[model samples]
Target: MRTLAYSLDVRFKPLFEVMGSLHAYICRKSHKKLDLSPSWAQQVQQRITPELSDLLDGIGIDGDWKLTYLLVHLCPGEDAADFVEWLKGMAAGDLYELMSPYSNLFPAHMGDFRDRTVRLFQQWNEQYMQHVDPEIIERLHVEAMKRKQALPASDPFAFVDETTNGLQFAPMNELKQIILMPQYHFQPINVVSYFGKVTLCHYAARIYLGDEDFLTPHEYRMIRSVAEKSRLKILKYLRQGPRSFIEIVRHMELSKGITHDHISKLRNAGLLTAHFEGETLTAYSLRTGALEQIHSKIMGYIEQGMA
Candidate 1:
């Protein structure tokens, strides 16, 4: 029922995908839990040189993932290559100034921050991004445009919430913009980034290139998600109320990685809702609407396809 004060800007900038590709590579190195297939992981491992591997660590990818927010706010246009070129002539002080309000970007560390970001992105652009297929970027743009057209002007926030699976945040009077970007690298999960008064929500876009041997229904994905014992247990725990991830970990007495994996799958299946303040996850709750429709969804799928 909550609505934004106004219709916010919903953009489909390719710059997000550019950064997402880099972030995805870093996740492969640090988290080792990417939803991407084993083949994708193996390909990344094969493509990475020792220098790129070391650079991923050296850039502190595992720390805060907000290093690219500066570009989000200040980039002159939507082109990724142009943004990088613009960043080349940017002074360290200017970079620090722009990034400081959103993060604790210090003047003392500005030079290294700028240099490392430039080097990291430059290497990534040459090694991988330049050869990216145009079709992938086109897919993201097409999805975003559809969502934008389908947006209900009265409750714009709902579109964001639905697109992001479960990312929710209270409306802010000071908020100026909300960006609904699409990313393919982090399939089946959402990435929400905060920059000053702007909120960037990056939802997953599945790459369906020539692999659509058959159609899979959302109901089927939801069924498969809860078919496992661990996921069902996680859902049961959330039945009571929303719980922070740490709280869920303690209550379930499971390792952090396993807990995260379960939550990610549940989120992807649209069975769970995640709330956030800034970039930090506040809590997670079950999407009772989806649960309530289990029978209807199953019957609908059967009637349409089987019956």
Candidate 2:
């Protein structure tokens, strides 16, 4: 058993190294920029590294995936077939679809690692930019900046300063959210989507709102701590109209155990409202008025930040 565990760890060594470095990078950044706390570490791990780890797991079989990544470190090339075949021989065939070009457009189970890896290589090579084509990078940077400008000044979903700043990283959160979606789109370049327009729009809202660095330091931390990628869907549903506990559970298709805990937290925070429909319990109308006003204000903050 010990040997097996050791071998498995060895097989995943490359993955561990990359993720460990990236995790440290984010932690350092968060610490310097965002008052990194224990909670912040948890958030970064949950929102960032683990997502990448899952992707690595999906694409890897035994050591092949890890080997391919390591080879990239050693050889740095476009083609990954030899490494892919080597990994394939060791593990199940499930990850082939994820590795195939056809599925590259859709969201890979990897989440931000695609970007993170790109960033990592750039760090490794110390260049003007990394990963993406220069033209594409310029285009995306422009588009991201432009999108940052166009976000509404006052959205209908914001609650307080915490919620406002919470919206900052929500796009990354949405990427994580989409990763879990049964119909998630994986376009390697494009960040938009097709299936489930409502769900997509909910994601779109976060993109539109973009970054929010205007909040005070403490406020930003509070927001970041509360609003997570996993909660984005729940926030979306709340936006349309609040639902009863039962309704949210039904709509989200989450387990009762999970939904109950999340709902309790949201309600405690005043982001959601819960009540009774006859003998049964209910909630209604996503946050509006104050929440809406706050949401919009943060959106405006995002625009200004982009500018």
lDDT: which candidate is best? Answer: 1
The lDDT for every candidate, in the order shown, is 0.71, 0.35
Residue clash pairs of candidate 1: none
Candidate 2 residue-wise lDDT, 1-307, digit = tens? 0111000000111222233233333334333332223354454345444544453334422233332333333332332333333333332233344344212333333434344344343332222112313443333335434434433342322321122222111222113221111000111001112121111111111111224556643333334424765466787877776466677788888898888766544443335443322113335444444355456657878899899
Write candidate 1's Cα lDDT for 14-133 as tens digits: 777778877776666534344566577567656767787687865544334465654654688676667768788889878767666666645346667666777777777777777778
lDDT score for candidate 2 against the true structure? 0.35
CA-RMSD of model 1? 3.3
Superposed by TM-score, candidate 2 places the C-alpha of residue 19 at a distance from the truth, in angstroms, of: 47
